[model samples]
Target chain A: MKPKYTSLQLFALTALRVSIGWHFFYEGFTKLLNPNWSSAGYLNDSQGWFAGLFHAIAGNQSLLAAADFLNVWGLIAVGVGLLIGIFSRYAALGGMLLLAFYYLSHPPLMNASYSLPSEGSYLWINKNIIELFALWLVFLFNTSSIIGIDRLLKRK
Target chain B: MSNDAENSKLLGRRNLLKALATVPLLGTLTYAGLKKHSNTAANNVEVLNALGFPKNTGLSIKPGAVGTIIHNNNPHIRLGFIGVGGRGRHLMQCAGFAPPEYVQDWMDKHAENPDDNRYQNFLEQDDLNVSVIAVCDVFDEHARLALEAASNADKKGQKDFKGITVKRYKTYQELIADKDIDAVVIATPDHWHAPIAIAAANAGKHVYVEKPMTNNVAETYELKDAVIKSGIAFQVGHQGRQTESYIRAKEVLDKGVLGKISLIEVTTNRNSPNGAWVYDLHPLATPDTIDWKQFLGNAPEIPFSPERFFRWRCWWDYASGLSGDLLTHEFDAINQVMNLGIPHSCVASGGVYFYKDGREVPDVFQAVFEYPNRDLTFLYSASLASERHRGKVFMGHDGSMDMDGVTSVYVDRASIKYKDLLDRNLVNPDEPALTFSSATGNIDAITSPTAKYFAKRGLLYTYRDGKRYDAAHLHIREWLDAIRNKQQPSCDIQQGFEEAMIAHMATISYREGVKTYWDAEKEMIVKGNSVKM
Candidate 1:
């Protein structure tokens, strides 16, 4: 029982989803191609609330490899699912969870700092949090079902 | 056509369009990703060529390729220690021996916290196939502890370890003369390092003595002769020679990356009583429990004081203080890279500025050496009251290198050698030109200040097969490998002689209040105005 959207609203929302999906896909794809890429550096530089957990994962090789694996492939799976509106609701939620991890691991706290540079200064809200918010809206809206593969599936 | 047929055909077309609408974008993404990848690779080659490193593939000297080559049939070396103090025990641990209590404690630490990898690294250390058979220390307590550690050759828990007869030789001479011992690790005071090593070398046992390898120039010459005459493997304990970053530093220096190097500044910063060598007097130390006369060993004859016995580094009679104790390390690290063998002249100055304790050695000191041939100056400085690390820096006309745990290079702003790079914005003066990590053999461009921060911390290291190697352990392993393979170690007696001479020159300069000069042609420390001004 979602609310109806105007054609313009639907187009804009769909474009936002596709853009985010493309960004996630490219990031994960590049990491997959780079044989030496690992999440160790980013995890070691993790600050804020979940630093302890992140550092622990980074210290152990096996756990670090698993974390790197999940991070790379999870992004790809979520991106592909969201792109074509295949299980678009679940994909949106998964993307939100990943964003939450990123936000918490290195949140823009007033006193805390990061060794990984940010593109811009922020206060309690970075690009990760912004994307998470956008994904939340994407989850609430039904543009994907209206004009996506979900539309064709809905016929059956 | 019927109305139902027309409606069905239109619905099928709309559904087909909707279901596959964004699929074409995936094809477009593939094209873009492929294009970006190829462009990045081409850009990398262009940058390499611009830097005049077209042939550079990876590390100039890959540690994996030239690292310790442990033969399958390596001999089992029987080791005996002359001193079992803190440093002595660490050397023993590096040689694959740790007391049962420490073994259990390490295990407990790992069990309490999974992230504690010290115990894990100890376990993963290669079995050097060696055992301690004899130990000699002036103190009763240290000798007893050495015996306990020696018997735990397996480096395992208490239950797993069975006892062995670790003979406690009351004197180093007795320990060296033991027929069963194949090598002697001399970790005694500076005064005892040469005499004991000389005696051990004469006794046909290989020697690994701590640095400053000898207390004076005379001893240095005599020890070199004795080692050569004995025909035994001799290694000086400069563990930094085994440090991966330092190895890479040498390779880079040989390439003349820091062109026209004019100055090399090395520093030591510490702030603690222990750091100042004000070690606590052992409560158990007494004339009955300690060999006072034996500990004197050519030092001035005096009534035994527990402070003198425990804090021997604070005295001129036993050790050469900051010059020989600390500065030798910095000097040797430079020597390892630049091969600045023996400086032409040295001038040193300092006093007991920070620690007011009745110690002959200065707590803050500095020394400068002139390498006239190379047109370079080496400056060394120290402060025992400050913990701020002013790292070792090699300054040059083209660039500068700052080395400690990592080596980072920064191009000079007005560098003519790199003028093209600067103008093209390929390299930045404010940012690091390159950050080299020996762990991965990768030189990364520092694009941001944040990346530079992490680069300094050396966070790029990943576990090599989930095992960590200690530099000291590697040093000991190399010595053993040399012994087995019948080759001289990296820091052989020849290198040790140079280290001792330079360190002695600094010591003599500070003590005599005059500039000291090493007449390399005559191998003499000319004290007066013997050299041309």
Candidate 2:
């Protein structure tokens, strides 16, 4: 297949995927090493429409444990998959879903509130939603075959 | 759109569908794992109860008959006084101990007004049947003064307490050994509190020990075990346990009025030298009068300095410093309202900044305790050099409670969960939705400077039927009633153990310069080492 996009555009798209992969990998790795760490505090302080659902999960010990394991491992799996450009599209899909859950847990919609200090103000969109869209672009562009391990595998 | 972009979008859509299909499979696996690993629903109820919210709205072991004295037609409980210093003298007074000169002076000071509540309460002490049969102290003057006060109970104009004879003992062991003494009140230095209480428990005598309940973590566990084995009534001296505002706060908390508390801030402040534990050394506290050896029981033997004898709270050898002397009060008060047993880990930092005297404890301190399981954090701070009063603040998602002298719950203006309630005026936003104030009349009417300060801060007492009752008196009455009823007092040994462990963790963290943790399985404080402040 002949190259479709300019080289610079392809490079930018690959860089975005790598950067997001690094962010997810670091978060998961840090949490994995800290045995006592839990997401209960964040879930318990969830705001907006899904607050009750988040609280219910937080209150359920078994459910919370499962959620913590899945969340941490899923982040690592997706990050590694995306970083190596193996199953990159699937990684983007999984990342977007996780980001959606984060957005729903504490949506930045107007009038939604939280007691914890915020880093910045947002109306209807925040970092999670923005990253979800960025992941979508990465998934649509399918740059893995252009410069990633997917290209080497295809050559075989 | 470009043909290449369209082709990419089609490919992405196909891939998204395949990935999305795996989510439900993962969800099913997760559900199966949770079902296999999670505790039963019934177990969650127990976990929630352990997290400080029991099914019972009232945490009191015995709920009704809080302030009333039930005679049960039993003989007056024989009581003994141990370590009768400032706090001991106060407890003695609460138990109807008043010398003739003291009563007469109080009456004269109050202009002989028969309606004066303090004097009136003394006159109405016919119902408090506790008879002080023994007095003990290492200090001769303290023991003598306690004996004199106990002997002059008739001076309160109460005919029932006439001609009482209180025998004096030179040591707590002798006092506890007395056959006639049915119960013992311990208001000694922190080092002596647990030893005397444990001995009293083993001697088949009820105990009322001052807080912090033990000098160290090991003593706390030992005292708790002794009390449980002995099955005697044990009350830790956290008088605020009986405060009306705390009871009301507990009720409100049980009702979930201030939903899901995540953070609590408690503070203590004092400006006077005496409040900083620079207590006055009695002029007669010489080596001849004070049995310095007896007073230094289990503590390092130091030359008899009147400062160490009178102000032992300033030293680590005899006390837990601010953690035991002051933080315990704040912790107990909050515990009564919130039932916060203990924190998982604590980090503390402080130092002796103000009083340059040769004291060992810090004059300013701050500690943060993290409760990972409960998803809560408690912050405690104290300063002896500043008079700026900071009360306890419980911050929750729906509302926040500010409890200083009064208890007030304010709805969070930006509360998403309670937005509809706020909009419909179900929860008011302008003012506190619930307010509990113990003050009813003019604050100046309270004569004692101490009483005035407490009343101003809503700490000393609470009003019932338009009449004020001292929290200490109420607390003592509760202990006596528990003894007669064979029920647990408000602040029992288990509760005391929890309070002491947390307080000791803060002290240890500050002294050892490390984060402290509770080893629940071992029932000990982790990384705890006794370091001089």
Clashes of each: 0, 1
Measured on C-alpha atoms, candidate 2 has an lDDT of 0.76
> Each predicted complex: what DockQ?
0.51, 0.01
CA shift at B426, candidate 1, in angstroms? Answer: 1.1
Candidate 2 deviant stretches above 4 angstroms: A1-156, B1-73, B112-117, B156-164, B424-430, B438-461, B528-533
Q: Compared with the true structure, what per-residue lDDT tens digits does model 2 show for residues B112-200?
A: 54324466567665457778888999888888778878887565533333553778888788889999889999999999999889899
Best candidate, lDDT: 1
Ten-residue stretch with the least lDDT total in model 1 chain B: B459-468
TM-score versus the correct structure, for each prediction: 0.92, 0.63
Off by over 4 Å in 1: A1-3, A47-52, A107-113, A117-127, B1-40, B50-52, B55-60, B159-164, B445-452, B460-467
Q: Per-residue lDDT tens digits of candidate 2, residues A54-152? A: 887875669899989989998988776666576788999999999999999989877877654467998889999999999999889887766555654
